[model samples]
Target: MDKNRMELNGFKWPDGDVHCRKVVFSSVIDMEPALRLTDGRAVAVQAGGNCGVWPAWLAERFERVFTFEPDQTNFDCLVQNVPENVTAYRAALGSKRGRVGMCLDTRNIGAHFIDGKGSIPVKTIDSLKLKACDYLCLDVEGYEMPALIGSVQTINEHRPVIQIEDKGLSERYGYQRGEAIDWLKMLGYRVRHRVARDVILSCAPA
Candidate 1:
Protein backbone atom coordinates (compact mmCIF):
# COMPACT_ATOMS: atom_id res chain seq x y z
CA MET A 1 0.00 0.00 0.00
CA ASP A 2 1.37 3.39 -0.93
CA LYS A 3 1.57 5.91 1.90
CA ASN A 4 -0.99 8.14 0.18
CA ARG A 5 -3.39 5.40 -0.91
CA MET A 6 -5.78 3.70 1.45
CA GLU A 7 -7.64 0.43 1.12
CA LEU A 8 -11.32 0.23 1.97
CA ASN A 9 -14.06 -2.21 1.03
CA GLY A 10 -11.23 -4.07 -0.79
CA PHE A 11 -10.61 -1.07 -3.03
CA LYS A 12 -7.56 1.16 -3.13
CA TRP A 13 -8.58 4.80 -2.84
CA PRO A 14 -6.90 8.16 -2.83
CA ASP A 15 -6.22 8.88 0.81
CA GLY A 16 -7.61 12.38 0.84
CA ASP A 17 -11.09 11.33 -0.38
CA VAL A 18 -11.33 7.99 1.33
CA HIS A 19 -14.20 9.24 3.42
CA CYS A 20 -16.84 6.73 4.55
CA ARG A 21 -18.26 5.67 1.17
CA LYS A 22 -17.24 8.14 -1.50
CA VAL A 23 -14.31 7.67 -3.82
CA VAL A 24 -14.33 11.26 -5.06
CA PHE A 25 -17.32 13.21 -6.26
CA SER A 26 -20.57 12.61 -4.38
CA SER A 27 -23.87 11.68 -6.07
CA VAL A 28 -25.36 15.10 -5.43
CA ILE A 29 -23.30 16.58 -8.25
CA ASP A 30 -22.65 13.47 -10.26
CA MET A 31 -25.93 11.56 -10.13
CA GLU A 32 -28.71 13.72 -8.74
CA PRO A 33 -29.66 15.75 -11.80
CA ALA A 34 -30.51 12.63 -13.72
CA LEU A 35 -32.45 11.14 -10.86
CA ARG A 36 -34.45 14.31 -10.44
CA LEU A 37 -35.23 14.54 -14.15
CA THR A 38 -36.17 10.93 -14.74
CA ASP A 39 -37.61 10.22 -11.31
CA GLY A 40 -35.02 7.55 -10.59
CA ARG A 41 -36.00 5.53 -13.64
CA ALA A 42 -33.07 6.76 -15.69
CA VAL A 43 -30.94 4.14 -17.34
CA ALA A 44 -27.48 5.52 -16.85
CA VAL A 45 -24.12 5.25 -18.56
CA GLN A 46 -21.15 6.39 -16.54
CA ALA A 47 -17.42 6.42 -16.94
CA GLY A 48 -14.25 6.39 -14.89
CA GLY A 49 -15.60 4.09 -12.24
CA ASN A 50 -12.67 4.82 -9.95
CA CYS A 51 -13.61 2.31 -7.28
CA GLY A 52 -17.28 1.57 -8.04
CA VAL A 53 -18.48 4.19 -5.57
CA TRP A 54 -20.25 6.31 -8.19
CA PRO A 55 -21.80 3.33 -9.91
CA ALA A 56 -23.09 1.94 -6.65
CA TRP A 57 -24.51 5.33 -5.86
CA LEU A 58 -26.20 5.50 -9.24
CA ALA A 59 -27.67 2.04 -8.87
CA GLU A 60 -29.43 3.20 -5.76
CA ARG A 61 -31.20 6.00 -7.61
CA PHE A 62 -31.40 4.86 -11.21
CA GLU A 63 -33.15 1.91 -12.77
CA ARG A 64 -29.96 0.54 -14.20
CA VAL A 65 -26.38 1.76 -14.20
CA PHE A 66 -23.64 0.90 -16.65
CA THR A 67 -20.14 1.96 -15.66
CA PHE A 68 -16.81 2.02 -17.52
CA GLU A 69 -13.32 1.97 -16.09
CA PRO A 70 -10.16 1.91 -18.16
CA ASP A 71 -7.68 1.39 -15.41
CA GLN A 72 -7.22 -2.32 -14.82
CA THR A 73 -6.41 -1.90 -11.17
CA ASN A 74 -9.42 0.30 -10.64
CA PHE A 75 -11.56 -1.96 -12.75
CA ASP A 76 -10.64 -4.86 -10.54
CA CYS A 77 -11.69 -2.88 -7.54
CA LEU A 78 -14.86 -1.72 -9.25
CA VAL A 79 -16.01 -5.20 -10.15
CA GLN A 80 -15.72 -6.44 -6.62
CA ASN A 81 -17.29 -3.43 -5.01
CA VAL A 82 -20.24 -2.40 -7.18
CA PRO A 83 -23.73 -3.73 -6.62
CA GLU A 84 -24.86 -6.70 -8.69
CA ASN A 85 -27.30 -4.55 -10.59
CA VAL A 86 -24.61 -2.18 -11.78
CA THR A 87 -22.99 -3.42 -14.98
CA ALA A 88 -19.28 -2.64 -15.05
CA TYR A 89 -17.18 -2.45 -18.18
CA ARG A 90 -13.44 -2.72 -17.91
CA ALA A 91 -12.85 -0.59 -21.04
CA ALA A 92 -12.98 3.15 -21.40
CA LEU A 93 -15.69 4.84 -23.47
CA GLY A 94 -14.67 7.11 -26.35
CA SER A 95 -15.56 8.29 -29.84
CA LYS A 96 -14.41 5.07 -31.44
CA ARG A 97 -13.81 1.45 -30.81
CA GLY A 98 -10.20 0.41 -30.31
CA ARG A 99 -7.41 0.36 -27.76
CA VAL A 100 -5.39 3.14 -26.14
CA GLY A 101 -2.90 3.65 -23.34
CA MET A 102 -3.46 5.45 -20.10
CA CYS A 103 -1.42 8.12 -18.36
CA LEU A 104 -1.05 6.55 -14.94
CA ASP A 105 -1.08 8.50 -11.70
CA THR A 106 0.73 7.52 -8.55
CA ARG A 107 -1.43 9.38 -6.08
CA ASN A 108 -4.93 9.72 -7.49
CA ILE A 109 -6.33 6.66 -9.24
CA GLY A 110 -9.06 8.77 -10.78
CA ALA A 111 -6.49 11.03 -12.43
CA HIS A 112 -5.49 8.40 -15.00
CA PHE A 113 -6.20 9.57 -18.54
CA ILE A 114 -5.95 8.12 -21.98
CA ASP A 115 -2.54 8.98 -23.44
CA GLY A 116 -3.32 7.20 -26.78
CA LYS A 117 -0.81 4.37 -26.64
CA GLY A 118 -1.74 1.74 -24.08
CA SER A 119 -3.28 -1.72 -24.11
CA ILE A 120 -6.52 -0.61 -22.55
CA PRO A 121 -9.47 -1.08 -24.86
CA VAL A 122 -11.76 1.77 -25.92
CA LYS A 123 -15.42 1.34 -26.85
CA THR A 124 -17.94 3.89 -28.00
CA ILE A 125 -21.12 4.42 -26.03
CA ASP A 126 -23.02 3.89 -29.24
CA SER A 127 -21.48 0.47 -29.40
CA LEU A 128 -23.61 -0.59 -26.47
CA LYS A 129 -26.77 0.15 -28.44
CA LEU A 130 -28.63 0.69 -25.22
CA LYS A 131 -32.41 0.62 -25.57
CA ALA A 132 -32.83 3.50 -23.17
CA CYS A 133 -30.37 5.94 -21.71
CA ASP A 134 -32.04 8.71 -19.79
CA TYR A 135 -28.87 9.88 -18.09
CA LEU A 136 -25.16 9.88 -18.75
CA CYS A 137 -22.25 10.86 -16.54
CA LEU A 138 -18.66 11.14 -17.71
CA ASP A 139 -15.51 11.80 -15.69
CA VAL A 140 -12.94 10.50 -18.13
CA GLU A 141 -10.19 12.96 -17.33
CA GLY A 142 -9.90 15.10 -20.51
CA TYR A 143 -11.74 12.78 -22.86
CA GLU A 144 -15.30 13.81 -22.06
CA MET A 145 -15.72 15.39 -25.49
CA PRO A 146 -14.80 12.23 -27.33
CA ALA A 147 -17.01 10.20 -25.06
CA LEU A 148 -19.88 12.57 -25.70
CA ILE A 149 -19.19 12.50 -29.42
CA GLY A 150 -19.35 8.74 -29.30
CA SER A 151 -22.67 8.93 -27.53
CA VAL A 152 -24.35 11.17 -30.09
CA GLN A 153 -26.87 8.59 -31.14
CA THR A 154 -28.07 7.93 -27.63
CA ILE A 155 -28.10 11.63 -26.85
CA ASN A 156 -30.08 12.43 -29.97
CA GLU A 157 -32.54 9.67 -29.38
CA HIS A 158 -33.11 9.77 -25.63
CA ARG A 159 -32.22 13.37 -24.80
CA PRO A 160 -30.78 12.21 -21.52
CA VAL A 161 -29.68 14.53 -18.79
CA ILE A 162 -25.90 14.61 -18.88
CA GLN A 163 -23.37 15.47 -16.20
CA ILE A 164 -19.76 15.84 -17.27
CA GLU A 165 -16.65 16.82 -15.41
CA ASP A 166 -15.25 20.01 -16.91
CA LYS A 167 -12.06 20.83 -15.08
CA GLY A 168 -10.37 22.54 -18.08
CA LEU A 169 -8.05 19.58 -18.47
CA SER A 170 -9.11 18.86 -22.04
CA GLU A 171 -5.89 20.37 -23.34
CA ARG A 172 -4.34 16.97 -22.80
CA TYR A 173 -6.76 15.69 -25.40
CA GLY A 174 -6.16 18.59 -27.77
CA TYR A 175 -9.44 20.29 -26.99
CA GLN A 176 -9.97 23.94 -26.16
CA ARG A 177 -11.34 24.91 -22.75
CA GLY A 178 -15.10 24.35 -22.48
CA GLU A 179 -15.09 22.50 -25.78
CA ALA A 180 -17.42 19.77 -24.55
CA ILE A 181 -20.01 22.21 -23.25
CA ASP A 182 -19.68 24.24 -26.42
CA TRP A 183 -20.31 21.19 -28.54
CA LEU A 184 -23.26 20.16 -26.39
CA LYS A 185 -24.68 23.64 -26.76
CA MET A 186 -24.44 23.23 -30.51
CA LEU A 187 -26.84 20.33 -30.05
CA GLY A 188 -29.15 22.48 -27.92
CA TYR A 189 -28.18 21.08 -24.53
CA ARG A 190 -27.72 23.76 -21.93
CA VAL A 191 -25.98 23.79 -18.60
CA ARG A 192 -28.35 23.33 -15.69
CA HIS A 193 -25.89 23.24 -12.83
CA ARG A 194 -22.20 23.54 -12.11
CA VAL A 195 -20.90 21.72 -9.05
CA ALA A 196 -17.26 21.77 -8.26
CA ARG A 197 -15.68 20.38 -11.47
CA ASP A 198 -18.87 18.75 -12.76
CA VAL A 199 -21.27 20.41 -15.21
CA ILE A 200 -24.85 19.15 -15.56
CA LEU A 201 -26.56 19.45 -18.92
CA SER A 202 -30.01 18.65 -20.30
CA CYS A 203 -31.77 19.16 -23.62
CA ALA A 204 -33.94 22.25 -23.80
CA PRO A 205 -37.59 21.25 -23.95
CA ALA A 206 -39.33 21.73 -27.25
Candidate 2:
Protein backbone atom coordinates (compact mmCIF):
# COMPACT_ATOMS: atom_id res chain seq x y z
CA MET A 1 0.00 0.00 0.00
CA ASP A 2 1.12 3.54 -0.68
CA LYS A 3 2.29 5.15 2.53
CA ASN A 4 1.93 8.72 1.34
CA ARG A 5 -1.05 9.71 3.43
CA MET A 6 -1.49 12.20 6.28
CA GLU A 7 -3.83 14.69 7.90
CA LEU A 8 -3.77 18.28 6.66
CA ASN A 9 -5.91 20.96 8.27
CA GLY A 10 -8.24 18.18 9.48
CA PHE A 11 -8.49 16.59 6.07
CA LYS A 12 -6.90 13.54 4.41
CA TRP A 13 -4.01 14.39 2.14
CA PRO A 14 -1.75 12.20 0.04
CA ASP A 15 1.44 13.65 1.37
CA GLY A 16 4.06 14.18 -1.36
CA ASP A 17 6.65 16.62 -0.17
CA VAL A 18 9.65 14.49 0.70
CA HIS A 19 11.16 17.40 2.56
CA CYS A 20 8.24 17.97 4.95
CA ARG A 21 5.41 15.52 4.16
CA LYS A 22 3.14 18.54 3.99
CA VAL A 23 2.77 21.57 1.76
CA VAL A 24 0.70 24.60 2.56
CA PHE A 25 -0.93 27.10 0.27
CA SER A 26 -0.07 30.70 1.07
CA SER A 27 -3.72 31.24 1.91
CA VAL A 28 -7.20 30.02 1.10
CA ILE A 29 -8.76 31.64 -1.95
CA ASP A 30 -11.14 34.32 -0.76
CA MET A 31 -14.81 33.74 -1.65
CA GLU A 32 -16.38 36.90 -0.28
CA PRO A 33 -16.30 38.77 -3.56
CA ALA A 34 -17.81 35.81 -5.36
CA LEU A 35 -20.60 35.47 -2.88
CA ARG A 36 -21.31 39.19 -2.95
CA LEU A 37 -21.27 39.59 -6.72
CA THR A 38 -22.86 36.46 -8.05
CA ASP A 39 -26.56 35.74 -7.75
CA GLY A 40 -25.89 32.17 -6.64
CA ARG A 41 -22.94 30.28 -5.23
CA ALA A 42 -23.20 27.63 -7.88
CA VAL A 43 -19.73 26.66 -9.04
CA ALA A 44 -16.04 27.19 -8.44
CA VAL A 45 -12.99 26.01 -10.36
CA GLN A 46 -9.46 25.29 -9.22
CA ALA A 47 -6.49 24.36 -11.36
CA GLY A 48 -3.33 22.68 -10.14
CA GLY A 49 -5.34 21.00 -7.42
CA ASN A 50 -2.54 18.97 -5.92
CA CYS A 51 -3.94 16.57 -3.31
CA GLY A 52 -7.14 18.60 -3.05
CA VAL A 53 -6.39 20.80 -0.04
CA TRP A 54 -7.82 24.05 -1.41
CA PRO A 55 -10.58 22.31 -3.28
CA ALA A 56 -11.74 20.64 -0.10
CA TRP A 57 -12.12 24.05 1.50
CA LEU A 58 -13.98 25.36 -1.52
CA ALA A 59 -16.40 22.45 -1.33
CA GLU A 60 -17.93 23.96 1.79
CA ARG A 61 -18.57 27.34 0.22
CA PHE A 62 -19.75 26.49 -3.26
CA GLU A 63 -22.46 24.06 -4.25
CA ARG A 64 -19.97 22.42 -6.63
CA VAL A 65 -16.25 22.66 -7.19
CA PHE A 66 -14.59 21.50 -10.40
CA THR A 67 -10.88 20.92 -9.92
CA PHE A 68 -8.20 19.86 -12.40
CA GLU A 69 -4.89 18.10 -11.83
CA PRO A 70 -2.65 16.52 -14.45
CA ASP A 71 -0.36 14.42 -12.32
CA GLN A 72 -1.58 10.85 -11.95
CA THR A 73 -0.34 10.22 -8.43
CA ASN A 74 -1.53 13.63 -7.30
CA PHE A 75 -4.83 13.06 -9.07
CA ASP A 76 -5.35 9.89 -7.07
CA CYS A 77 -4.66 11.81 -3.89
CA LEU A 78 -6.96 14.60 -4.99
CA VAL A 79 -9.79 12.20 -5.70
CA GLN A 80 -9.34 10.68 -2.27
CA ASN A 81 -9.00 13.90 -0.26
CA VAL A 82 -11.66 16.16 -1.76
CA PRO A 83 -15.24 15.99 -0.49
CA GLU A 84 -18.15 14.60 -2.52
CA ASN A 85 -19.18 18.13 -3.48
CA VAL A 86 -16.00 18.46 -5.49
CA THR A 87 -15.49 16.95 -8.93
CA ALA A 88 -11.89 16.18 -9.78
CA TYR A 89 -10.64 15.98 -13.32
CA ARG A 90 -7.41 14.22 -14.17
CA ALA A 91 -6.20 16.79 -16.66
CA ALA A 92 -4.28 20.04 -16.81
CA LEU A 93 -6.15 23.26 -17.49
CA GLY A 94 -4.89 25.28 -20.43
CA SER A 95 -6.14 27.48 -23.25
CA LYS A 96 -7.52 24.54 -25.20
CA ARG A 97 -8.05 20.80 -25.50
CA GLY A 98 -4.85 18.87 -26.02
CA ARG A 99 -2.12 16.79 -24.41
CA VAL A 100 1.19 18.01 -23.01
CA GLY A 101 4.07 16.91 -20.86
CA MET A 102 4.85 18.07 -17.36
CA CYS A 103 7.98 19.08 -15.51
CA LEU A 104 7.47 17.03 -12.37
CA ASP A 105 8.57 18.15 -8.92
CA THR A 106 9.44 15.10 -6.88
CA ARG A 107 10.05 17.08 -3.72
CA ASN A 108 7.04 19.40 -3.95
CA ILE A 109 4.19 17.87 -5.91
CA GLY A 110 2.39 21.18 -6.15
CA ALA A 111 5.27 22.66 -8.10
CA HIS A 112 4.79 20.46 -11.16
CA PHE A 113 4.27 22.32 -14.45
CA ILE A 114 3.94 21.95 -18.19
CA ASP A 115 7.10 21.21 -20.15
CA GLY A 116 5.17 21.34 -23.47
CA LYS A 117 6.49 17.95 -24.39
CA GLY A 118 3.84 14.31 -22.37
CA SER A 119 0.46 12.68 -22.56
CA ILE A 120 -1.42 14.73 -19.97
CA PRO A 121 -4.63 16.01 -21.44
CA VAL A 122 -5.00 19.79 -21.31
CA LYS A 123 -8.47 21.26 -20.83
CA THR A 124 -9.98 24.73 -20.62
CA ILE A 125 -12.24 26.08 -17.89
CA ASP A 126 -14.82 26.78 -20.57
CA SER A 127 -14.97 23.06 -21.26
CA LEU A 128 -16.86 22.54 -18.03
CA LYS A 129 -19.86 24.49 -19.43
CA LEU A 130 -20.91 25.46 -15.96
CA LYS A 131 -24.23 27.24 -15.54
CA ALA A 132 -22.57 29.62 -13.15
CA CYS A 133 -19.08 30.24 -11.75
CA ASP A 134 -18.87 32.14 -8.53
CA TYR A 135 -15.15 31.80 -8.11
CA LEU A 136 -12.05 30.48 -9.84
CA CYS A 137 -8.60 29.95 -8.39
CA LEU A 138 -5.59 29.00 -10.48
CA ASP A 139 -2.14 27.98 -9.31
CA VAL A 140 -0.66 26.30 -12.34
CA GLU A 141 2.97 26.99 -11.50
CA GLY A 142 3.21 29.91 -13.98
CA TYR A 143 1.20 28.45 -16.82
CA GLU A 144 -1.61 30.74 -15.75
CA MET A 145 -1.75 32.83 -18.90
CA PRO A 146 -2.90 29.96 -21.05
CA ALA A 147 -5.35 28.86 -18.42
CA LEU A 148 -6.68 32.39 -18.13
CA ILE A 149 -6.90 32.66 -21.87
CA GLY A 150 -8.97 29.52 -21.91
CA SER A 151 -11.27 30.92 -19.25
CA VAL A 152 -12.03 34.22 -21.01
CA GLN A 153 -15.55 33.30 -21.99
CA THR A 154 -16.50 32.16 -18.53
CA ILE A 155 -15.09 35.31 -16.98
CA ASN A 156 -16.91 37.46 -19.49
CA GLU A 157 -20.13 35.70 -18.72
CA HIS A 158 -20.08 35.22 -14.96
CA ARG A 159 -17.49 37.75 -13.75
CA PRO A 160 -16.33 35.41 -11.00
CA VAL A 161 -13.60 36.35 -8.61
CA ILE A 162 -10.27 34.92 -9.77
CA GLN A 163 -7.26 34.21 -7.63
CA ILE A 164 -3.99 33.50 -9.43
CA GLU A 165 -0.62 32.57 -8.05
CA ASP A 166 2.07 34.81 -9.43
CA LYS A 167 5.41 33.94 -7.93
CA GLY A 168 7.11 35.22 -11.11
CA LEU A 169 6.67 31.77 -12.66
CA SER A 170 4.96 32.91 -15.84
CA GLU A 171 8.29 33.15 -17.63
CA ARG A 172 8.34 29.39 -18.04
CA TYR A 173 5.32 29.69 -20.32
CA GLY A 174 6.88 32.55 -22.38
CA TYR A 175 4.84 35.23 -20.70
CA GLN A 176 6.39 38.35 -19.26
CA ARG A 177 6.40 38.35 -15.48
CA GLY A 178 3.23 39.89 -14.02
CA GLU A 179 1.52 39.65 -17.35
CA ALA A 180 -1.55 37.99 -15.90
CA ILE A 181 -2.50 41.15 -14.05
CA ASP A 182 -2.51 43.08 -17.30
CA TRP A 183 -4.51 40.36 -18.94
CA LEU A 184 -7.07 40.44 -16.17
CA LYS A 185 -7.15 44.23 -16.40
CA MET A 186 -8.31 43.91 -19.99
CA LEU A 187 -11.03 41.55 -18.76
CA GLY A 188 -12.16 44.32 -16.38
CA TYR A 189 -10.90 42.66 -13.20
CA ARG A 190 -9.07 44.91 -10.84
CA VAL A 191 -6.90 43.48 -8.13
CA ARG A 192 -8.98 43.43 -5.00
CA HIS A 193 -6.37 41.90 -2.73
CA ARG A 194 -2.85 40.58 -2.83
CA VAL A 195 -2.40 37.68 -0.51
CA ALA A 196 0.84 35.84 0.24
CA ARG A 197 1.36 34.35 -3.19
CA ASP A 198 -1.88 35.05 -4.96
CA VAL A 199 -3.61 38.05 -6.45
CA ILE A 200 -7.36 38.08 -6.03
CA LEU A 201 -9.14 39.76 -8.92
CA SER A 202 -12.78 40.80 -9.01
CA CYS A 203 -15.07 42.79 -11.23
CA ALA A 204 -16.75 44.49 -8.31
CA PRO A 205 -16.13 48.21 -8.08
CA ALA A 206 -14.11 49.55 -5.23
- Highest TM-score: which candidate? 2
Poorest 10 consecutive residues of model 1 by lDDT? Answer: 17-26
> Which regions of candidate 2 fall more than 4 Å away from where they truly are?
1-16, 19-26, 29-39
TM-score of 2: 0.89
Give the C-alpha miss distance for residue 10 in model 1, angstroms: 7.5
Off by over 4 Å in 1: 1-30, 204-206
Candidate 2 positional error at 47, Å? 1.2
lDDT of 2 by residue, 1-206 (tens): 35776666665555656642444543453544434555556898988888787888888878999999999888887887888999999999889899999988778777788897689999999987778988888889999999999989999998888888889899977899789999999889888777677888888877
TM-score, per-candidate, Cα-based: 0.87, 0.89
- In model 2, the Cα lDDT at residue 70 comes to 96
For model 1, residues 83-109, the per-residue Cα lDDT tens digits are: 878999899888998889888774567
lDDT for every model?
0.80, 0.81
